[model samples]
Target chain A: MAKPACKNLEEIFRTPHGAVYQCNRANCFWLEFAGGISAFKASDFLHLKKQVEQIDVPEMVQNTARMADIVILNPFRSERCFVLTVTDVLNLRELLQGAKVMLDLNSMLYDCLHAMAV
Target chain B: MKDLLRLRTSLTEEIETLLNEQIKVEAHSSSVYLAMSSWCNRNGFDNSADYFQKQSGEEREHMLKLFGFINDMGGRAISPEVTNIPQEFESFRAVFETALQQEIYVTQQFNRIADRCFKAKDFMSFQFIQWFLKEQIEEEYIARRALELFDVIGEEGTGRWEIDKQVPKIKYEN
Candidate 1:
């Protein structure tokens, strides 16, 4: 018989100060937290995190899902490590679908910003 | 003179300008590919090097196609100014990544040229550029696929080494 999966959400959410929970499963809920801050502020990362949670439902879980692989918290600033889960890794396939969209969007925004500056 | 002929002449001139820009980009692409080939050869990736060497020839062929088209239109074909190619590469992956980037640049250039010709009502030049636009798609695909293969093999895998061995031996007929 298949073993019932244990709920590890609490362990997954636990993190050291100035750090966040990062997921490592093929596809699961994983994210990092700010070090030294109480775990109560988990709501701050809810923006993109909500999109991932939706994938758990059978009807909501499509063959493809767009999820961030490495969530960089204040990526440009400090040693804020990114978290990724197994589900997030699997979701990368969807993110790559029509992969040119992000690249084209970036170039378009860059051109627009440059034009504005000029 | 008929209004159609006058419009045709004006359209041809516009196409000439766009084609000139395209030829310059092609020249740049050829140089970049040659440099990449040389880097691959030096880094024990002879297959990748040979592949880029062929790619350089292909880009030159693309330039020639534009050159011929401009001459056929009775427009003055300007000499393309190609910049110097960089000699050093940090890794094989970097070389292929650069090639992929160049291919994307070339594809965008071709699209711009084709759009300009279309706007000018120069159907002939637009049709000619259509082939080039299609070619760029394939070029980008090949470059991207090469990079993906490199990723699969890893930076120092025997698979990459074996593929490198096949590089010098493989020769394109055209």
Candidate 2:
């Protein structure tokens, strides 16, 4: 039996700054970051991961401009925005990378279990 | 928990990415054909210009087919941004040579996509791409035949004009 509060949400990965959860009922991922929770569809989540990974940390570090110290992301189909600093970006990257690895592992497990069932 | 990812999309990430890449390839091919059409028209090869226009339209149709299929399967279809289209050609024969090369590249891309679909066990996409694979036979055939026109009719005096006139007649029966 699942916990009552988390009946629909499954924790995929966690870090000190943030964590990733999947809502099986909604078929979306719930991102706990920046003192808020944003829900993203699976494909949107992958796109967001790509956007974050594409951030150039070295450029941000080298540039003396204040704006260069951070990056902004407006996720698709969402009103919420992420304004992340270089440190924040690194943390988020770690969180997302962990979640992606967990997701891949889950997919492999699902395939194996289904193959056995078949 | 239920597999939310699989529930959200029928396409695996790898397959989805590959399909999007193919979409870009098709769009780029369409743009290149359109540029070829323009070059032919500027060079006064009217028949070859029309042929390339028709080919461009067909390539756009192919792009749309892949785009529709991706969306139908609950995957995102990206509208590709095409660049680096050549605006000029060296000579009349060079145009047909480039066209044939483009067709061959497109066939190779479709073959790669089919191979990926097979490996992923996504038989639906594999079956869908079979139409493209078969269409490639006609595409490559027509392009090859048009290029052969330059060889059959030497490009010395009125040879280019004759080749341009016969370009529209090149057909693939099978």
DockQ for every model, please: 0.01, 0.59
The list of candidate 1 runs beyond 4 A from truth reads A1-118, B1-11, B163-174
**Tens digits of per-residue lDDT for model 2 on B1-174?**
567667667787778888899889888888888999999899888988999999999999999999999899988899998889888888888888998999999999899989999998889999999999999999999999998888899898999999999999888886
Candidate 2's TM-score on the B chain: 0.97
List, residue by residue over B1-174, the lDDT tens digit for candidate 1: 012212223334346667888889888889989999898878877677778899899999988988887767655566788777788887777887888899998888888887887786678888888898777767876776677766565647487786555434433233
Return the TM-scores of chain A for each candidate in numbered order. Answer: 0.21, 0.93
Residue-level error in angstroms, candidate 2, position A93: 2.5
TM-scores of the models, in the given order? 0.53, 0.90
For model 1, residues A1-118, the per-residue Cα lDDT tens digits are 1112434322322212212221222222223332222222212233233333334444335435455323332322233343545444334324322222332343456557779999
lDDT of 2 by residue, A23-107 (tens): 8878889888878788898889988997999999999999999889889999988777999999999999999989988987887
Model 2, which residues run further than 4 Å from truth?
A1-5, A61-65
